[model samples]
Target: MGAYMSEKKYTKDHEWVSIENEIATIGISNHAQESLGDIVFIELPSVGNSVKAKDEICVVESVKAASDIYAPIDGEIIEVNNNLENDAAIINQDAENDGWIFKMKISDSNQYSDLMSEDEYKQFLEQ
Candidate 1:
């Protein structure tokens, strides 16, 4: 839908991460939100929590389904997108930008290498 999202890394599970300034912004992909439909609630992790790669950190519930938002890397949770609690549709409206699920201080940037790049993720979808 809408050509999917651009310029973001992806996971086999369909999570996406955008890296900037050693901080990672994470969310589900556009295709994910389109498929989930009419998001109604989000459950985020508390601040100051430590998260490991692939950890289940959030739960996003939509009219069609509820899914876990996994951690793409090991890191401590510096900030959760509090805005989502009040406006979960922000995620459906702008999954990559204002709707990002969380911002984290990465524990090892090198670990990011294990994730799929935008191009790689695109290929994953083609499969």
Candidate 2:
């Protein structure tokens, strides 16, 4: 594979986004899953659904509560992680990687730059 395509960016709400070839992969952060605890269900967005940045994209339910996942950039949903349908705990195990929730072909790549960097996210959490 080519060198890593993009740095992951984060939302204040704990979603993370990474873009490659115009497609943005989105997932909740580890802190989010840990806080939610033992995710039990996920309602994924449909492929082809168009969304604006900050729009509610899906829902995740844990033993503790249900959390909303938001779109980090304007886009049309292109794919979702089907594994989550049967096993929502995948997110608890790897919120940033194998547990990615959806992929969307972004409407504006520039929006990626506006999100927090990993360092900024960590500092935000510390605060």
| Highest TM-score scorer | 2
**Candidate 1, 1-127: lDDT as tens digits:** 3333234678888888877777787888988898899999999887888999988988999998889988889998888899999999998999877888888888898777788998898899899
Candidate models: Cα lDDT each: 0.85, 0.93
Per-residue lDDT of candidate 2, residues 24-65 (tens digit): 899999999999999999999999999999899799999999
Candidate 2 collision pairs? none
Q: TM-scores, in order shown?
A: 0.89, 0.96
Q: What is the lDDT of residue 112 in candidate 2?
A: 90
